[model samples]
Target: MKKILILANNDVGLYKFRKELIRELVKDYKVYISLPNGNLIPELEKLGCEFIETPINRRGTNPITDVKLLWRYKKIIKSTNPDVVLTYTIKPNVYGGIVSRISKVPYISNITGLGSAVENGGILQKVTLTLYKLSLKKAHCVFFQNKENEEFLSSNISIGNKRLIPGSGVNLEQYSLLDYPKSKEIHFLFIARVMKEKGINQYLEAAEYIKKKHPNTVFNILGSCEEEYEEKLKEMNNKGIIRYHGMQKDVQKYFRTAHCTIHPTYYPEGMSNVLLESAASGRPVITTNRSGCREIVDDQENGFIVMQQDSKDLIQKIEKFISLSYESQKGMGIYGRKKVEKEFDRNIVVEAYINEIEKINKSIS
Candidate 1:
């Protein structure tokens, strides 16, 4: 049997995003997974796959610790001797690819997004981009979740093989729409990690402005607050402008009951799973015109796309939705459901991965 090894920074990255792909691959290959320990190990084991406990720091950089991680992964690769490797996230794609190259194991990488390093341009961005260009040059195949990212790689890096897949595909059947709930109040939901880059503060400010005119309108935020922005977010939550539900495991439940999903991210994203899931659940989206977020939303059709970081533009869009008739709102949501069915279905994406893997195997063989 062909041997496959998967690498990720955290267990959630393996569990939430790549679970479907893993399940499919395990049928024919001896699959091994490497990630930080988390709640997913038992479930992954249940799927008849082997797991290796690899300590990977999911957050900020430490040169000393990163070197240790590189050595550890190098050891793992040398021992496992897998025929093929798949890696995702910035650290894994760059560092893992380098290790795989040294081991002479064929590998594929998925660049989900350009995170802080590239988004917050500086020395780190320059260094990370250089590393990416180097690591990605000879990759068997490099997949991007958005065209903007693909374009960046084509223009800036010397990547030879590339593919573009939608954001970790949404299960259209699972996220089936419910009837638009009739309520005295209209609720807007924002689901994302509570980071400045996610436009959390912008959402709060827009909520405050909207509430002043339409006091009954509700603004709800469902996401985990990180240490960097916790204090400020808590203060905002204390005010009646936004209702905080922390991180939610089942966001589809919330999406079903809400009128619209707001994702005003200024930071570049790979196609956002939140936006796709929300649209799949039949909720219209209000997000930025930026690359990853914009792909899922068609302005004035299924949802609206406002300019990034423009609180005034966000507030205007909110008001526009608020003023729409009940039938018009429902129509927007119906359009979204249709969009999801036609475009972001999970099966389509899984098959795409399978095809890519097969192509890689043929080429290398």
Candidate 2:
């Protein structure tokens, strides 16, 4: 059996998002996954993936420690001698790509997101782009989650092979459709990591503005809170302007109960999985008209897309949804469900990955 080694920053992310894809690949290949050891090691092992714990600093940029990571990747790859390698996230794609190239291993990479380095835009962005150009030029195939990122990277670098895939693809079976909740109150839910970049401020601004007018409507936030924004969010929750659900493992449960989902994020994303999961749960979405988030919706048909970073535009769109008849709102959600079924099914992503691996094997033989 061909050995396939995969690299990622953390175990939880690898297990949570790519579990299905890993399951699909393990049937034909001896799959090995490298991530920082965490509680999810057993879960990945259950999927038949050989769990290899590798140290990775998920946050921070200490040059000396980072250089050690590069050397460790080289050591790991040399020992494994895999036929093919695959990687995702920023650090893995950059460091792993370079190591795979140096070891002469056929490898593929997935650009899962353009995080703060690119979003913040300054010296960091310039340095990040330079690193991407150097590391990604030699990969066998490079997959981008959204077209905007694909266009941006292609314009900036000399990439040899490229493929654009729907953001990590949603599992329809798991996030199956649910009947719209029957209630006199319209419930709008926001599910994301609570931070400035995720547009938490715009969401709160809209919620604050809309609450005075529509007393019966409910605005709720369900996410892990960041330290800087935690007190402010808690204050809002105390004021009864919006309810804070905090972070929950079963977000699909929230989706099933919610009438609509709002993701007013301006963050440079790979693709907003929260939007996809909400859409798959048969709920209408309200998101920004930006790259990763916009690609998921049909604007007005499935959900509304508002201007990024503008709270006024977000308020207007939320109000527009409030005016819609119940049937129309439900129709919007149904359209979203159909959209995912047609375009962003998890099976499609797995098939594409398998095809690339097959091509690599054929070329070698």
TM-score of each: 0.95, 0.98
Model 1 error, position 197 (Å): 1.0
Position 136, candidate 1: lDDT: 83
Model 2 lDDT tens row, 73-113: 89889888899999999998999999999888999999998
RMSD of each: 1.6, 1.1
The segments of candidate 1 whose C-alpha lies over 4 angstroms from its true place after superposition are 227-239
Q: Of the candidates shown, which would achieve the greatest TM-score relative to the real structure?
A: 2
Candidate 2: residue pairs that collide: none
lDDT (0-100) at residue 61 of candidate 2?
84
Which 10 residues in a row give candidate 2 its minimum summed lDDT?
Answer: 51-60
- Candidate 2, residue 38: how far the Cα is off, in Å: 2.1
Q: Candidate 1 lDDT, tens digit per residue, 221-327? A: 89888898777767767877778899888887787679999999987768898888888888889999898888898899888999889999999999999989888
CA-RMSD of model 1 = 1.6
